[model samples]
Target: MISISDDVKVVENFVRVAQIIANLESILTQAKNLSLTAKNARVVALRAGDAALGFKPITNFIDEFSEQTIASTTKIADLSNQLFKVAHKLVRCSQYFHQMTLLKTHINSKQADAMYQEALKSQRRAASQLSLALSELENHFEDIQKQMQSAEYIAVTSRVEATNAGDFSDSLQSVSDFIASAAKTIKTAVVYNLSEIHTLRGVLK
Candidate 1:
C-alpha cells in the first residue's frame, strides 16, 4: 500500500543520485588527464637538464593533486553503487504494489487502467534517467581517451627533443613507449565501455 508520494520521492532520489555520479565521473576524467600531463612534463624536465630545474616542484604538486582526485572518485563510485541498489529495490517495490492491486476484485477497470498507465510512465522515466547516466559515463570515457592520446604525443615530442639535443637516454625511450602503450590500452577500454552503453541505450529505447 505504498502511496504515490512515496513512489515520486524514490524516483526523485534516484535522479539526484545519478546526477551526482555523472559529476563525479567528469571529475575523475579530468584528474586522469591532469596526471598524464604531469607525467609528460616530468619527462620533459628530466631531458632539459638544469634549465628546467624549476619544474620539479610543480610536477610534484600535480602528482599529489592527481592522487587526491583518484581517492575522491573512488569514494563517489562506492556511494553511487549503493544508491543504485536502493533505486532498484524501490523499483521492485513499485512492481509488487502493481501486482497486488491487479489481484483485487474490488478495483474498477478505469482505476486499474489508470494505475497501469502511471506505472508504465514511471518505468519509462526511470529508463530515460538511466540512459542519460550511461551517456554521461561514456562521454567521460571518451574524454579520457582523448587525454591519453594527447599525453602520448607529448611524451613522444619530448623524447625527440631530447634526442636532438644529444641527451637521448634509455630511460627517456622507455617512458615514451610506456605512455604510448598506456594510451592504447585506455582507448581500448573506452571503446568497450561505449559499446556496452550503446547496447543498454538501445534496449531501453
Candidate 2:
C-alpha cells in the first residue's frame, strides 16, 4: 500500500509538472503575439518605403525568431508530456513494488517471490525511463535558452534599425519594444519552467 506521505509526494510532483506545462503554454502565447507584431512591423516598414529599408530586414528576423521560438516550445511541450507520462508510470511502479514488498513479509510462496522480483524490475525500469525523460527535458530547456539569447540579439538590432527609419522611427520603435517585451516574457517562462523541472527531478529522486 502507498503511504499517505507517498501519495502527497506524488501529488506534489504532479503539481510541478502542471506548472511546467502552464509555463510552456505561456511561451506559446507570447510567441504567437511576437509573430503578429512582426507582421505589423513589416507593414509599417513597407509604408515607410526606402526610409525604413533597414527596418524591413529586422522585421524578417523578428518573424524568424518567433517561428523558431514556437517550434522550440512545441518540442518542449511534447517532451514535457512524455516526462509526465513517465513520471506517472514511475509512481505506479513504486506503489506496486511497495505492495509486493509488504506481501513478501507475510507470504512464502515461490510465485509471490517471483512477482516481487518482477515488481522490483519494473520499478527500476520506470526509474531509468524517468531519468532519460528528465535529461531530454534539460536539453530542450537549454535549446530554448539559446533561442531566447538569439531573440534578444534580434530585439536589440531591431531597436538600432528602428532609430534609422526616419519618419517611421516611432512606429518601428514601438515594434522593437514589443519584440523586447515578448522575448523577456518567453525567457522568463523558460527559466520558470526549468526551475519547476528541477523540482520535479528532486521529487522523483
Candidate 3:
C-alpha cells in the first residue's frame, strides 16, 4: 500500500510543476506586451523623421528580443510539462513497488517475487527519466536568465535613443519605459521560476 508520505510527495511535485507553468505564462504575456510596445516605438520614430532615426533600428532589436523571449518561454513551458509527466510516472511506479512489497506477504511467493522484480525495474526506469528531464529543465532556465540580461541591455539602449528623438522625445521615452518595465517583469518571473526549479531539484536529490 502507498503510504501517506508517498501521497504527500506526489502532491508536492504536482504543485511545483503548476507554479512553474503559471510563472511561465505570466512571462509570455509580458513578452507579447514588449513586442507591441516596440511596434509603437517604431511608428513614433518614423513620425519624428531624421531626429529619431537611431531609435528606429533599436525598435527592431526590441521586437527581436521579445520574439526570442517568447520562443524560449514556450520551450521551457513544454519542458516543464514533460517534467511533470515524468514525475507523475515516477510516483506511480514507486507506489506500485510499495503495493507489491505488501502483496509479497499475503500471496504466492513466486508470483509476488516476480511482480516485485518487475516493479523495481519500472521504478528505476522512471527515476532515470525524471533525472534527465530535471537536468534539461535546469539548463533551459539558465538560458532564459541569460536572454533576460540581453533584453535588459537593449531596453537601456532604447532609453538612450529616445532622449535624442527631438519633439517626439516624450512619446518615444514613454515606449522605452514600457519596454524596460516589461523586461523587468519577464526577468523577475524567470528568476522566480528558476529558484523554484532549483529547490525542486535539490528535493529530488
Sequence-dependent TM-score of model 1: 0.57
- The true-structure Cα RMSD of candidate 1 reads 8.2
Q: How well is each residue in 153-179 modelled by candidate 2, as lDDT tens digits?
A: 887888898888898899999887877
Give TM per candidate.
0.57, 0.93, 0.89
The 0-to-1 C-alpha lDDT of every candidate, in the order given, reads: 0.58, 0.86, 0.84
User: Lowest summed lDDT over 10 consecutive residues: which window, candidate 1?
Assistant: 161-170
Where model 3 places Cα greater than 4 Å from the true spot, the runs are 102-110
Q: Write the per-residue lDDT of candidate 1 for residues 108-200, one digit (tens) a residue.
A: 677776766766667666666665565555555565556655656655664564444334345445544554554565555446545645654
Candidate 1: global Cα-lDDT? Answer: 0.58
RMSD vs true structure, all candidates: 8.2, 1.5, 2.1
After TM-score superposition, what is the CA distance of residue 180 in candidate 1 from its true location, in Å?
Answer: 0.7
Q: How many angstroms is residue 13 displaced in model 3 relative to the true structure, after the best TM-score fit?
A: 1.2
lDDT of 3: 0.84
